[model samples]
Target: MTLQKVNLQEKFNLFQEQWRPKIVGELNGQHVKLAKLQGPFVWHHHENEDELFLVVKGRLCMELQGQEPIWLEPGEFLVVPRGVEHRPVADEEVHLLLFEPAGTLNTGNVQGERTVENLERI
Candidate 1:
């Protein structure tokens, strides 16, 4: 594969859908994804895979079960461990970069209308 640098803003400009994640890069069984998020997402957890969320713009409120919400801002990131139930909420449009195992489902263990089984590569 040809190696090239990815511009976050340029890649983000290619899509405008919320909750849907687009693949940007990959390495060592992990995928670097970009997504635009607004509103609340389903509460779910990966049975085996861990997830990393990095805010590129706006704010993210990560809600953990039976605990207070953790807020993330631009340039900030949070790692949600495996099997830990969590939900991501955004009051406004938020740009995010996610690092997780390849083929990891956006909806985790929950298979619902919001689940994205086929992720688009941008």
Candidate 2:
């Protein structure tokens, strides 16, 4: 395989869909994905895996069950523990980098309009 560098801004420019995560790279059974998010997302939890969300641009709000919401700015990241109920909200367009198992669903336990099973690679 040929090794190559990934440019975040360039990768993000390829798609305009919101809530859809595009795979950028993979390693050790995990996928590195990039996505654009806006509005409130459904509440859900991963049954067997933790999810890492890194804010690459704009703001991201992580609402946790039984706790105050956490806000993330560019260069910040949050790891949602497995089985913990949480929802992500973004008032404006937010760019995100996600690190999780290759088969991890965008909507986790709940199958909804936002669930993306077959992720596209950028």
- Candidate lDDT scores, in order, read 0.96, 0.96
Off by over 4 Å in 1: none
Candidate 1 accuracy as TM-score: 0.98
Summarize candidate 1's per-residue lDDT along 11-76 as a digit string, tens digits.
999999899999999999999999999999999999999999999999999999999999999999
lDDT of 2 by residue, 4-99 (tens): 999999999999999999999999999999999999999999999899999999999999999999999999999999999999999999999999
Q: What is the TM-score of each candidate against the true structure?
A: 0.98, 0.98
Root-mean-square deviation of candidate 2: 0.6
Question: By TM-score, how accurate is candidate 2?
Answer: 0.98
- In terms of TM-score, the best-performing candidate is 2
